[model samples]
Target: MSSTLQDLVNRAVFYSTEVQTHFGALIADAEWEVDFSSDPHLTFTPADGAVLRTRPHLLGSESDREKTWLWGWENVNDFPDAIVGLSHEVRKFGAAEEVSELTTPELSLDEELALRLTLAAKEATHKWAHYPAAAGAGTTVWLLVDAAEIALPAPQVKVSVRALMQGLTQTTVTDHRAAIESYVAKRGIPTAELPEGGLRMLFADGSADLSFDDQRRISNCDLNAPLEGEAAEQFAAAAESTGTPAEAATASRTSGSASAPAAEETAAPAVPTPSAPAPTPTDEPSRTEPQPVEEPAAEAIPVAEPKPDEPAAEAADASHEQKQPENEQPRADESVQPAEAATPAEEEPAEEAKPKKKGLFSKLFGR
Candidate 1:
């Protein structure tokens, strides 16, 4: 309805091997002739089936040849059979055992066209597109839909290559070929010309493969395994298998080298002990016990000189003063000096008194 083949294709139809092979041949070898003298209108209705109105070729009847052709929708019922027969006949041309035996019902025309368009677009765009060489070569078109852009198709329309690519890229579904044709119709492509009467590109060798209801365009090419889910698993297995012991050791060394310096930086500093240093002569006094200062005072005393005996007169007078006659010698000069010095036994009281006084002074003055 939006002017794209995707608008007409139904997702329910899957392209069988027979359909893909046949369609490829149709594009390669089919000869289509168009008349531009008068425009013809063709319509397909549920009630009438497929109808064609045109006199493009001569008919057996004069009236049939003279008037515009009209065919009913009922003719489409024979379409499957016609398409299958056409494929079988074309298969003989390819001569591949697999291609020649392909069936139609098993293939979806819309889906196959979509796949081709996708691959072609890649080629045209200078990108590589890959598809299974065979229709039944275990390949499937997987679509990742964006719900906001494209709605699911009804049971009527078949999926096509152009539809699949457009759906994937624009996140929408429509007949890509129809959209482009409609676009170009308003402003023609400089190098392309419309067919004599048909809505398709005309070329010397052949016409572009454009269908009226089931049109298509190409988007990309990818391996089949992604859709099958086998490629990823195989890659993972290969990666795991290739990791050897050498790699493990190298990884371990790398990890160790990274952390070694950081670990050393976090360790605490060591403390130095006093004895751990070398012993020097200046340090000897600090280790020795101190000497007392009082011992040196006693060793410094000088010898006392003895005095000569006093004169006889002085001695006689000192003796007479203590009631002895002046002419008598003083009793061993005792009158002039204390008698304790001449008598050792008398010296004991003086020595004892001196010590008692010193003891009393020491206690009071705390000397």
Candidate 2:
């Protein structure tokens, strides 16, 4: 049962930085023992006896890597059975900003830790502590004493702000180191040790506990915990502390109470419209008269009298030939044809042009 509990916690909080520190201290001072009825013996194990340590990074032969430690102290026989104890407390604070606002350095590591502990405590008391035990031990416990301490990471932390922004924009979840660096830059906060190995997160209050993986993302956040309500109130108070007027723009629009400004914009355009109506109709009549005359002129030019000249020229030439001798026509026509008759050959195209309107394409192709 002890091993099982330890394993469960280890799985839960293995990646947490604070939890890592706590576990490190624990591993460095841990002791494990088993007392059987057969032997009835209590063995003294060294405080640092049960710790496991190893090089967490792989490097070449000459390279040195950081060491990781897992520590625990366990005793199967010395369970605190006379009276079990449980307690809970929630400390909550909340803040709000515009959706466009950036994360601020308002929260100290200690404050965040307090929030976590508060959440953890509430969970311990209301959710987990009363759970049926695997060991079959049954008893009610009360908190005789409890304390929660918070240590916040310092300000002015250097981080890769650009990397964080880019990663966020690109939705790249894998490069958290870059994102963390970017987060530091953007928030102007100090860079703390990141989760380098398989470490995850853990939270515990006087009563309960919660944990998450190494992503530094929260798991099992209990917003319904009373602590969270206080947090929300704190956030509201923080916003009020700024003394900035609450934004009423949306409400103003909804209720039409503040429509005077919009009305001013709309009212200016109204004055011009009545004046505009008078000139619009007057200008329209002049435009229509010019357009009708121009349309007919353009249409009549091609279809009028040009094509009838082809037949008229043939008739005039036949009359001219009737007045000339056949021999003179053969001889004098070859040398001195009448200019009027010669001119009609050049003018025949003008005659053919009269039929052009019947073929829309004839005018375009110069037929």
Candidate 3:
């Protein structure tokens, strides 16, 4: 009976944990116990959990000596016995003593779960606890607790959303683990159990850690935790804010500043190129016009002539002959000096000298 009770205690803890997971901490304020002494009793307190109130039979069937109680349950002479015969069991269970003595208000997880599950037990012959509703109300699971041992029934727990999370935890029942694993295996989840700890669920492309917190009722998805969609997307958007969001102008300025030096390196050569050759175009055409002016030596020819030598040319008869070509073109009116104009009036001298030369020739020829 002791070994059996130990196993039942383990099963009871596991059972209460599953209930807590489904109903959301129904035993948060409740305390329960499973005491095995001369008169074994399942004692507990504050039996107003959603599971207890929802399942009335958990308080046990009322004896024939029905005395008025708080909410339709058996009560003692002085008090309603909401503590449910736990006052005497206080010394046996130190936690009950602490609660009775008010030594400490806080309850450990194991103690709290045990007390709640035990309080959930009703009749010494048969005590029943419920699983989350399957189809209609819910699936009711009965635990037969007596002075000897506790017994759990092999009943189907109408699988709820909580059932999906059942096998992922450390305290799920054997049947639930089988059902969850079988279903997961059929879907090709490719599960592999770890030696150190934990269960690994594999997908076709990726995998995730299948671990749930019985206390917090959450999964430890590890790296694959919610990192997408709405809430995760909001988180992702806020993640970018860590570096401080830059404005459009600021971003552009950063890029422009980074490229500024290279642009300056390229543009440095080009800017001076235009200015360096600026005078070349103007200088080349200016030099070409003066090149033709140097070729005309007529202006320089006047510099080589002496102004005093022009009067000697009047005595030379060849100069008079040379004047014939000059008279073919008219000289400038201001340039026509008397010394330079004697050729046109030389007709009188030519006729007078011709007759004197003929008389001298006749005397020589005896004509």
Candidate 4:
């Protein structure tokens, strides 16, 4: 059978969930601020006053009023290439894979579309961490982030399984067997197919036996060894906090495709399943407070009206011009200016503009 967007989503959700859980723990109790300027970055300040910085790629934005999603590559806000270059790579991957959702500039919003697209992006771009920033006026901007601090350690059986369970509650998954298979292959975990149609995954610490029903839905998940200490506690807590896969499926059916923040809001915090303990203050890099930047005035989400098509070479040239240098360092004193209203045709390059290097997605995905 030909692959659908849902199939891509199923293959990505498990690994995405595991990495997102690790990311949440790192930024727990932290305040975030984004600056889109010559040097774009997202700063996080925890209660302990340590500064954690990450380079953010604008994946897309969801508007509650418009009930639509706008891909970053659409350039609606006239954001710099530094902030949106990765999104272009996503579009290219989508075009190559024949996934229409990734290639489409605008889409009607659904309860889970933003999260699903983010998961698909994770699979394609191999950037495992993402953040849903509330960009005022009922819009949530979904960003895929990169930083050394958010990297995942070696995979653990308990942690992976907890993420799997948590992922089922967060979004709709049609094929649990495929989800598990994709996750294992992505993570490079050893596995074997059982004679009775079950699959056994071998982890360093233990093993898990997964059985699927005739519909390819997961029926039973049995771990060879019981979890201990905090792992067991986190697993139990996640189970109690979220509904079962059956319940999630029912909700997906009844909930119409209206823009809702519940999926974005609940996905990160739903499971208290932190993959690791919070970092100590001493371990963080010492840094000054991030300078305050002026917030842009609230406006209605930009509607994705049809546009005349440009020549393929012209479009490729425009994309090349927008690709920003990945190694440009942020200046501490720099303040974010509001995005200009001028069209891309009207904007001129600065004399001091840094030379472009490989796009972020190109480096990560090697495309």
Candidate 5:
């Protein structure tokens, strides 16, 4: 069967969600600034003085005013090959898989189109981390980022389920059941199919039982050990912030079809085929600092626009010279101070000292 964009997204979102959550926690207190010069880099500078940096590939841009998405390979702003290289891979994968959405240069936007495309790109490229940077003019440029600090450790049940719950609030999911199954398989988490049309996911610490409704929507989620502390609080907040899937579906219909094109595309740009770089030395050692509590928001970084007469050749040469090392760089987790650590002992609450419940999702959907 031909792979659809939705299929790719369903396969990728669950894993991507967990990775993004871990990434978000790492940069929570930092300010994001991007530089798209000869070499593109996204930097996160937190209050505690630890600065984290990563290489970014421009995936695409979404325009709120126009309600459209333009792929990075379109190179409307004339971004360099290094920045748009990965997007070419995504398009080629789309062409091979016959996923029209991936090959289409411009598409109508919806509440979930940008994220959905990013998820599909993640699946195709095997890149787990992404960022949506706020470009000027009501446009948001999505980027797939790479850095050592953002890599996830082995999957844990509580963290995975928490990520699923948190991810649901950010985008519309058509089939929760499918997404969960795909996630477990991709993450290599052990799971067993229940006779009653449920799934039990086993983790080192505990397991979670998921039940689907007649329509295959996640009707309820139960955990062997209740969630408590920060994880529980985060899940409760995400649940409170989002509406039911039924409500999201209704809103999506009223907004517009995510796949509909605003105009006919003449042709996709020829995919650029860059030769692979030779292997480089191991990345600089990782930092040993603690992470801060604030999340980074997508904000424009100040960059001087190239003069009209600037030569493209010179820019490409400069980019080649300035390419980042192949190995992972020192991540923010090594140097920054965590929020709890920064807090004074005298200010600690007595209630926080008491033992808390282990399970948090004892029927998340109010069965």
Candidate 6:
């Protein structure tokens, strides 16, 4: 496995800077004591209850070892424990967790490493590499997976996802129930059968999950939560907590935010394909709404001359003649004479037109 890392550490396991900071915060509300020296490795010997430990391991194949990010609890007598990972008995040793393994057949070494690194940064816990400053206080406990800027962990020989799935199936009654209850005994989470045929674990928090096919190949991973009750709130408060800006950023970089190239389309175009933007429901309605086009009003067009024989036309002509300035005569192409001027008047009188009816508005407003 190829890892993009900035440092290399020995076999000694430890909590990351962020995790220590968070663990520190987890105890800020009460009387607490911290142990920094490596007794059985770096530890958090909280006086009241659980002891947290940071453990690191080279997780990749014997042929190629890459850095990985990992952390776990130290001495907790009971932690609804189960390793939902390919084979490990427990990954969320602290509490509220999950582990994903991609088969070499399903994902390449690089791809798996890429995915692991991505997840670790945001969700996974790394060994101690930073100093601790207890940032958590009040009733809430905030924990981080990295604080000392620990180097990433080595990628391991990941076990089969199907094996984990098989162990989690309902038929394996005890294991299946344990798989979920182990965490749910803490809090209720989500699990669903994918449309493409796979399994997923979900939480109310904005987390990521993998979607695989029947063959247990990851098809896609989506990065995508509610809460209730006093008892529920108390339970959540006790389950597990983490939030440290530095460690959050480190965890983000190592796991959930690891950068890797996406799979290119088999027949990708050299030039980008022009995609028509899909109209949203809101956009569609707005598109159908009438939008008036701006244009000059009809008054700008010259009015057509009326028929010559109509009495209204004759009357209009007479009115025009009256309205014209005496100085401005008709254009001379040698002006044509009127019937009266030519032969001393012999014109038929035309019928008068009826008046138009008043409109509704005109009648109502007396306009």
**Top candidate by lDDT:** 4
**Selected candidate, larger TM-score, 2 vs 4:** 4
Candidate 3 C-alpha lDDT tens digits along 176-226: 333435444322233556433445443222234444333322233332322
Candidates 3 and 6 compared by lDDT, better number: 3
TM value for model 5? 0.61
lDDT of each: 0.19, 0.18, 0.23, 0.54, 0.53, 0.22
**CA error at residue 362 for candidate 5, angstroms:** 25
Query: Could you list the CA RMSD of all candidates, in the order they appear?
Result: 63.8, 46.5, 60.9, 18.3, 19.3, 37.6
Determine which window of 10 residues in candidate 2 has minimal summed lDDT. 267-276
Which of 2 and 6 is ahead in TM-score? Answer: 6
**Candidate 2 displacement at residue 313 in angstroms:** 99
Model 1 misplaced regions, further than 4 Å: 1-43, 46-83, 96-367
Query: Per-prediction count of colliding residue pairs?
Result: 39, 22, 4, 0, 16, 41
Kindly give the stretch of ten consecutive residues in candidate 5 with the minimal lDDT sum.
Answer: 312-321
Please write out the lDDT profile of model 6 over residues 210-254, one tens digit for every residue.
Answer: 454333333444433112343234324433443333223222323
The lowest-lDDT stretch of 10 consecutive residues in candidate 1 is 311-320
Off by over 4 Å in 3: 1-6, 24-55, 59-191, 195-197, 201-367
Q: What is the lDDT of residue 302 in candidate 6?
A: 17
Order of all candidates by TM-score, from best down to worst? 4, 5, 3, 6, 2, 1
lDDT of 4: 0.54
lDDT of 2 by residue, 297-356 (tens): 101111111223211100000000111233322111111111110001123555476331
Name the candidate that leads on TM-score: 4
Off by over 4 Å in 6: 1-188, 206-209, 225-367
lDDT of 5 by residue, 178-252 (tens): 889888767655566776898776554445767777767666666654434444444344334554332232122
